[model samples]
Target: MKNYTTPILILFLFLVIAIIGNITISAIGLFFNHDVFNTGVYANGYEASLNIKLIFMAKAFALLMFIYSVYILIRNLKFLVRRDFFNNKLVQCFSKSGKLFFFSGIVGFLASICGILNIAIIKDFGSQAYLNIDSKSLYIMLMILGFFLLLFSKVLDKGNEIQQENDLTI
Candidate 1:
Protein backbone atom coordinates (compact mmCIF):
# COMPACT_ATOMS: atom_id res chain seq x y z
CA MET A 1 0.00 0.00 0.00
CA LYS A 2 1.12 3.56 -0.69
CA ASN A 3 1.01 6.36 1.84
CA TYR A 4 -0.87 9.54 1.06
CA THR A 5 1.14 12.71 1.51
CA THR A 6 0.15 16.33 2.03
CA PRO A 7 0.33 17.06 -1.66
CA ILE A 8 -1.97 14.18 -2.39
CA LEU A 9 -4.35 15.44 0.25
CA ILE A 10 -4.33 18.86 -1.33
CA LEU A 11 -5.00 17.38 -4.73
CA PHE A 12 -7.92 15.41 -3.32
CA LEU A 13 -9.33 18.49 -1.68
CA PHE A 14 -9.11 20.48 -4.88
CA LEU A 15 -10.90 17.78 -6.84
CA VAL A 16 -13.71 17.63 -4.29
CA ILE A 17 -14.13 21.38 -4.37
CA ALA A 18 -14.23 21.50 -8.16
CA ILE A 19 -16.67 18.63 -8.51
CA ILE A 20 -18.92 20.01 -5.78
CA GLY A 21 -18.89 23.44 -7.30
CA ASN A 22 -19.82 22.07 -10.72
CA ILE A 23 -22.71 20.04 -9.35
CA THR A 24 -23.96 22.89 -7.19
CA ILE A 25 -24.03 25.31 -10.10
CA SER A 26 -25.88 22.81 -12.24
CA ALA A 27 -28.48 22.20 -9.56
CA ILE A 28 -28.97 25.89 -9.02
CA GLY A 29 -29.58 26.55 -12.71
CA LEU A 30 -31.93 23.60 -12.99
CA PHE A 31 -33.90 24.69 -9.93
CA PHE A 32 -34.19 28.40 -10.69
CA ASN A 33 -35.36 28.12 -14.27
CA HIS A 34 -37.24 25.01 -15.20
CA ASP A 35 -39.19 26.46 -18.10
CA VAL A 36 -36.30 27.31 -20.39
CA PHE A 37 -36.72 24.46 -22.81
CA ASN A 38 -38.12 24.86 -26.31
CA THR A 39 -37.99 23.62 -29.89
CA GLY A 40 -37.18 25.78 -32.90
CA VAL A 41 -35.55 25.97 -36.30
CA TYR A 42 -32.85 28.27 -37.61
CA ALA A 43 -32.73 30.27 -40.82
CA ASN A 44 -31.37 27.15 -42.50
CA GLY A 45 -34.43 25.22 -41.34
CA TYR A 46 -32.26 22.95 -39.23
CA GLU A 47 -33.87 21.44 -36.16
CA ALA A 48 -32.76 22.04 -32.62
CA SER A 49 -33.97 21.36 -29.11
CA LEU A 50 -33.01 22.86 -25.80
CA ASN A 51 -33.90 21.74 -22.32
CA ILE A 52 -33.08 23.33 -19.00
CA LYS A 53 -32.04 20.02 -17.55
CA LEU A 54 -29.77 19.29 -20.50
CA ILE A 55 -28.13 22.66 -20.32
CA PHE A 56 -27.57 22.29 -16.62
CA MET A 57 -26.18 18.84 -17.09
CA ALA A 58 -23.84 19.89 -19.86
CA LYS A 59 -22.47 22.76 -17.86
CA ALA A 60 -22.09 20.61 -14.79
CA PHE A 61 -20.25 17.95 -16.74
CA ALA A 62 -17.97 20.53 -18.28
CA LEU A 63 -17.23 21.98 -14.90
CA LEU A 64 -16.38 18.54 -13.62
CA MET A 65 -13.88 18.11 -16.43
CA PHE A 66 -12.51 21.54 -15.71
CA ILE A 67 -12.11 20.53 -12.10
CA TYR A 68 -10.07 17.51 -13.02
CA SER A 69 -7.93 19.66 -15.24
CA VAL A 70 -7.44 22.06 -12.38
CA TYR A 71 -6.37 19.24 -10.15
CA ILE A 72 -3.59 18.45 -12.61
CA LEU A 73 -2.71 22.13 -12.63
CA ILE A 74 -2.58 22.40 -8.87
CA ARG A 75 -0.46 19.30 -8.68
CA ASN A 76 2.14 20.85 -10.94
CA LEU A 77 1.90 24.19 -9.22
CA LYS A 78 2.39 22.61 -5.86
CA PHE A 79 5.49 20.90 -7.14
CA LEU A 80 6.84 24.14 -8.58
CA VAL A 81 6.20 25.96 -5.34
CA ARG A 82 7.86 23.25 -3.33
CA ARG A 83 10.86 23.36 -5.63
CA ASP A 84 10.94 27.15 -5.33
CA PHE A 85 9.64 27.33 -8.91
CA PHE A 86 12.95 26.20 -10.31
CA ASN A 87 14.41 23.25 -12.17
CA ASN A 88 14.10 20.26 -9.94
CA LYS A 89 12.40 16.88 -9.76
CA LEU A 90 9.17 18.19 -8.31
CA VAL A 91 9.13 21.16 -10.64
CA GLN A 92 9.79 18.87 -13.58
CA CYS A 93 6.79 16.79 -12.64
CA PHE A 94 4.69 19.91 -12.25
CA SER A 95 5.81 21.29 -15.56
CA LYS A 96 4.87 18.13 -17.37
CA SER A 97 1.59 17.64 -15.56
CA GLY A 98 0.61 21.28 -15.89
CA LYS A 99 0.77 21.17 -19.67
CA LEU A 100 -1.33 18.04 -19.72
CA PHE A 101 -3.86 19.67 -17.43
CA PHE A 102 -4.02 22.92 -19.41
CA PHE A 103 -4.93 21.07 -22.60
CA SER A 104 -7.60 19.08 -20.80
CA GLY A 105 -9.08 22.21 -19.35
CA ILE A 106 -9.22 24.01 -22.67
CA VAL A 107 -10.95 21.10 -24.38
CA GLY A 108 -13.50 20.86 -21.61
CA PHE A 109 -14.12 24.58 -21.59
CA LEU A 110 -14.71 24.72 -25.33
CA ALA A 111 -17.00 21.72 -25.26
CA SER A 112 -18.99 23.20 -22.43
CA ILE A 113 -19.31 26.47 -24.27
CA CYS A 114 -20.46 24.73 -27.42
CA GLY A 115 -23.03 22.73 -25.50
CA ILE A 116 -24.28 25.81 -23.73
CA LEU A 117 -24.58 27.74 -26.96
CA ASN A 118 -26.39 24.88 -28.60
CA ILE A 119 -28.92 24.76 -25.80
CA ALA A 120 -29.38 28.52 -25.91
CA ILE A 121 -29.90 28.49 -29.65
CA ILE A 122 -32.37 25.66 -29.45
CA LYS A 123 -34.24 27.42 -26.70
CA ASP A 124 -34.58 30.53 -28.78
CA PHE A 125 -34.83 29.26 -32.34
CA GLY A 126 -36.60 26.01 -31.32
CA SER A 127 -35.26 22.51 -30.80
CA GLN A 128 -34.76 22.12 -34.51
CA ALA A 129 -31.64 24.21 -34.52
CA TYR A 130 -28.36 22.90 -36.02
CA LEU A 131 -26.32 21.49 -33.19
CA ASN A 132 -25.85 18.19 -31.47
CA ILE A 133 -25.93 18.19 -27.68
CA ASP A 134 -24.15 14.92 -26.93
CA SER A 135 -21.34 15.55 -29.38
CA LYS A 136 -20.78 19.11 -28.28
CA SER A 137 -20.70 18.07 -24.66
CA LEU A 138 -18.05 15.48 -25.46
CA TYR A 139 -16.00 18.02 -27.31
CA ILE A 140 -16.26 20.35 -24.35
CA MET A 141 -14.87 17.71 -22.07
CA LEU A 142 -12.08 16.94 -24.53
CA MET A 143 -11.32 20.61 -24.89
CA ILE A 144 -10.83 20.85 -21.15
CA LEU A 145 -8.42 17.93 -21.17
CA GLY A 146 -6.62 19.27 -24.22
CA PHE A 147 -6.14 22.70 -22.69
CA PHE A 148 -4.48 21.18 -19.64
CA LEU A 149 -2.15 19.13 -21.82
CA LEU A 150 -1.16 22.22 -23.74
CA LEU A 151 -0.35 24.16 -20.58
CA PHE A 152 1.60 21.31 -19.06
CA SER A 153 3.68 20.93 -22.22
CA LYS A 154 4.58 24.61 -22.28
CA VAL A 155 5.65 24.62 -18.64
CA LEU A 156 7.60 21.45 -19.06
CA ASP A 157 9.51 22.99 -21.91
CA LYS A 158 10.50 25.89 -19.73
CA GLY A 159 11.54 23.56 -16.95
CA ASN A 160 13.70 21.65 -19.34
CA GLU A 161 15.44 24.81 -20.40
CA ILE A 162 16.17 25.71 -16.80
CA GLN A 163 17.41 22.25 -16.12
CA GLN A 164 19.79 22.46 -19.04
CA GLU A 165 21.20 25.75 -17.75
CA ASN A 166 21.72 24.27 -14.30
CA ASP A 167 23.46 21.28 -15.78
CA LEU A 168 25.80 23.51 -17.72
CA THR A 169 26.63 25.50 -14.56
CA ILE A 170 27.48 22.33 -12.66
Candidate 2:
Protein backbone atom coordinates (compact mmCIF):
# COMPACT_ATOMS: atom_id res chain seq x y z
CA MET A 1 0.00 0.00 0.00
CA LYS A 2 1.13 3.53 -0.67
CA ASN A 3 2.27 5.65 2.25
CA TYR A 4 -0.50 7.72 3.82
CA THR A 5 1.60 10.78 4.47
CA THR A 6 0.39 12.72 1.42
CA PRO A 7 -3.28 12.17 2.19
CA ILE A 8 -2.66 13.08 5.80
CA LEU A 9 -1.00 16.31 4.83
CA ILE A 10 -3.79 17.23 2.45
CA LEU A 11 -6.46 16.47 5.01
CA PHE A 12 -4.61 18.45 7.64
CA LEU A 13 -4.42 21.48 5.36
CA PHE A 14 -8.10 21.22 4.52
CA LEU A 15 -8.99 21.05 8.20
CA VAL A 16 -6.83 24.03 9.09
CA ILE A 17 -8.41 26.13 6.35
CA ALA A 18 -11.91 25.17 7.47
CA ILE A 19 -11.13 25.98 11.08
CA ILE A 20 -9.72 29.38 10.19
CA GLY A 21 -12.64 30.24 7.92
CA ASN A 22 -15.21 29.17 10.49
CA ILE A 23 -13.55 31.21 13.22
CA THR A 24 -13.43 34.30 11.03
CA ILE A 25 -17.07 34.05 10.03
CA SER A 26 -18.20 33.30 13.56
CA ALA A 27 -16.24 36.23 14.98
CA ILE A 28 -17.65 38.62 12.39
CA GLY A 29 -21.18 37.43 13.04
CA LEU A 30 -20.82 37.85 16.77
CA PHE A 31 -19.29 41.28 16.41
CA PHE A 32 -22.19 42.60 14.39
CA ASN A 33 -24.96 40.96 16.39
CA HIS A 34 -23.63 42.01 19.78
CA ASP A 35 -25.39 44.72 21.79
CA VAL A 36 -22.12 46.58 22.14
CA PHE A 37 -22.47 47.86 18.64
CA ASN A 38 -25.28 50.39 18.71
CA THR A 39 -27.38 51.05 15.61
CA GLY A 40 -25.80 54.43 14.98
CA VAL A 41 -22.18 53.34 15.39
CA TYR A 42 -20.71 54.38 12.08
CA ALA A 43 -21.65 56.47 8.98
CA ASN A 44 -25.31 56.66 9.98
CA GLY A 45 -25.45 52.93 10.89
CA TYR A 46 -23.43 51.46 8.03
CA GLU A 47 -21.26 49.41 10.40
CA ALA A 48 -24.30 48.11 12.25
CA SER A 49 -26.03 47.19 9.01
CA LEU A 50 -22.87 45.60 7.69
CA ASN A 51 -22.53 43.60 10.85
CA ILE A 52 -26.16 42.50 10.57
CA LYS A 53 -25.51 41.22 7.08
CA LEU A 54 -22.36 39.52 8.33
CA ILE A 55 -24.36 37.70 11.01
CA PHE A 56 -26.58 36.03 8.43
CA MET A 57 -23.60 35.41 6.19
CA ALA A 58 -21.72 33.79 9.04
CA LYS A 59 -24.65 31.48 9.79
CA ALA A 60 -24.68 30.37 6.18
CA PHE A 61 -20.91 29.90 6.19
CA ALA A 62 -21.12 27.98 9.44
CA LEU A 63 -23.59 25.56 7.90
CA LEU A 64 -21.29 25.11 4.94
CA MET A 65 -18.36 24.56 7.26
CA PHE A 66 -20.24 21.81 9.04
CA ILE A 67 -20.94 20.14 5.73
CA TYR A 68 -17.26 20.28 4.80
CA SER A 69 -16.40 18.77 8.17
CA VAL A 70 -18.65 15.81 7.47
CA TYR A 71 -16.86 15.30 4.20
CA ILE A 72 -13.52 15.20 6.00
CA LEU A 73 -14.86 12.76 8.56
CA ILE A 74 -16.11 10.44 5.87
CA ARG A 75 -12.85 10.60 3.95
CA ASN A 76 -10.85 9.71 7.03
CA LEU A 77 -13.26 6.96 8.01
CA LYS A 78 -12.88 5.42 4.58
CA PHE A 79 -9.13 5.52 4.91
CA LEU A 80 -9.33 3.79 8.28
CA VAL A 81 -11.59 0.99 7.09
CA ARG A 82 -9.10 -0.47 4.66
CA ARG A 83 -8.21 -4.12 5.25
CA ASP A 84 -4.55 -3.42 6.03
CA PHE A 85 -5.35 -0.42 8.16
CA PHE A 86 -4.01 -2.05 11.32
CA ASN A 87 -0.58 -2.63 9.79
CA ASN A 88 -0.38 0.64 7.94
CA LYS A 89 1.09 3.67 9.67
CA LEU A 90 -0.72 6.11 7.38
CA VAL A 91 -3.95 4.28 7.90
CA GLN A 92 -3.43 4.39 11.66
CA CYS A 93 -2.82 8.08 11.48
CA PHE A 94 -5.96 8.51 9.45
CA SER A 95 -7.89 6.55 12.07
CA LYS A 96 -6.58 8.69 14.89
CA SER A 97 -7.32 11.85 12.96
CA GLY A 98 -10.70 10.43 12.00
CA LYS A 99 -11.68 9.88 15.59
CA LEU A 100 -10.81 13.46 16.42
CA PHE A 101 -12.63 14.63 13.32
CA PHE A 102 -15.63 12.61 14.38
CA PHE A 103 -15.71 14.41 17.70
CA SER A 104 -15.41 17.70 15.88
CA GLY A 105 -18.33 16.72 13.70
CA ILE A 106 -20.40 16.04 16.78
CA VAL A 107 -19.59 19.48 18.08
CA GLY A 108 -20.40 21.03 14.73
CA PHE A 109 -23.68 19.19 14.65
CA LEU A 110 -24.49 20.47 18.12
CA ALA A 111 -23.71 24.03 17.12
CA SER A 112 -25.85 23.68 14.04
CA ILE A 113 -28.68 22.38 16.14
CA CYS A 114 -28.35 25.30 18.51
CA GLY A 115 -28.40 27.73 15.61
CA ILE A 116 -31.52 26.13 14.25
CA LEU A 117 -33.18 26.19 17.62
CA ASN A 118 -32.32 29.84 18.01
CA ILE A 119 -33.84 30.60 14.63
CA ALA A 120 -37.01 28.73 15.53
CA ILE A 121 -37.24 30.50 18.84
CA ILE A 122 -36.81 33.84 17.16
CA LYS A 123 -39.64 33.02 14.79
CA ASP A 124 -41.88 32.02 17.67
CA PHE A 125 -40.86 34.93 19.86
CA GLY A 126 -39.20 38.15 18.71
CA SER A 127 -35.81 39.86 18.56
CA GLN A 128 -36.54 41.63 21.84
CA ALA A 129 -36.72 38.29 23.63
CA TYR A 130 -33.71 36.77 21.90
CA LEU A 131 -30.30 36.78 23.53
CA ASN A 132 -27.07 37.21 21.59
CA ILE A 133 -23.84 35.40 22.43
CA ASP A 134 -20.56 37.08 23.20
CA SER A 135 -18.09 36.90 20.30
CA LYS A 136 -14.94 37.04 22.43
CA SER A 137 -15.88 34.12 24.65
CA LEU A 138 -17.02 32.04 21.71
CA TYR A 139 -13.83 32.77 19.80
CA ILE A 140 -11.68 31.87 22.77
CA MET A 141 -13.49 28.59 23.27
CA LEU A 142 -13.22 27.68 19.63
CA MET A 143 -9.51 28.48 19.56
CA ILE A 144 -8.96 26.34 22.61
CA LEU A 145 -10.82 23.47 21.02
CA GLY A 146 -8.78 23.88 17.86
CA PHE A 147 -5.55 23.70 19.86
CA PHE A 148 -6.65 20.49 21.50
CA LEU A 149 -7.45 19.02 18.15
CA LEU A 150 -4.01 20.02 16.94
CA LEU A 151 -2.49 18.19 19.85
CA PHE A 152 -4.49 15.12 18.99
CA SER A 153 -3.27 15.34 15.44
CA LYS A 154 0.28 15.44 16.74
CA VAL A 155 -0.34 12.23 18.64
CA LEU A 156 -1.61 10.67 15.45
CA ASP A 157 1.56 11.72 13.68
CA LYS A 158 3.60 10.06 16.36
CA GLY A 159 1.52 6.91 15.92
CA ASN A 160 2.35 6.98 12.24
CA GLU A 161 6.04 7.29 12.95
CA ILE A 162 6.01 4.40 15.42
CA GLN A 163 4.11 2.23 12.98
CA GLN A 164 6.59 2.97 10.22
CA GLU A 165 9.50 2.03 12.45
CA ASN A 166 7.75 -1.16 13.50
CA ASP A 167 7.14 -2.08 9.88
CA LEU A 168 10.80 -1.57 9.03
CA THR A 169 11.90 -3.80 11.88
CA ILE A 170 9.62 -6.65 10.80
Over 64-152, each residue of candidate 1 has an lDDT whose tens digit, in order, gives 55455556555555455454544355444544454544454454456556556655665443431212323454445555655555565
After superposition, candidate 1 runs with Cα above 4 Å error: 1-22, 28-55, 76-78, 82-121, 124-170
Q: What TM-score would every model get versus the actual structure?
A: 0.40, 0.39
Q: How many steric overlaps does candidate 1 have?
A: 47
Error of 1 at 66 (Å): 2.6
- Residue 11's lDDT within candidate 1 is 71
**Candidate 2 local lDDT, 113-142, one digit each (tens):** 554565666442222111242233443444
Worst 10 residues of 2 by lDDT: 124-133
Q: What is the C-alpha RMSD of each candidate to the true structure, in Å?
A: 9.4, 10.8
Q: Which segments of model 2 are wrong by more than 4 Å?
A: 1-48, 83-145
Per model, state how many residue pairs clash: 47, 0
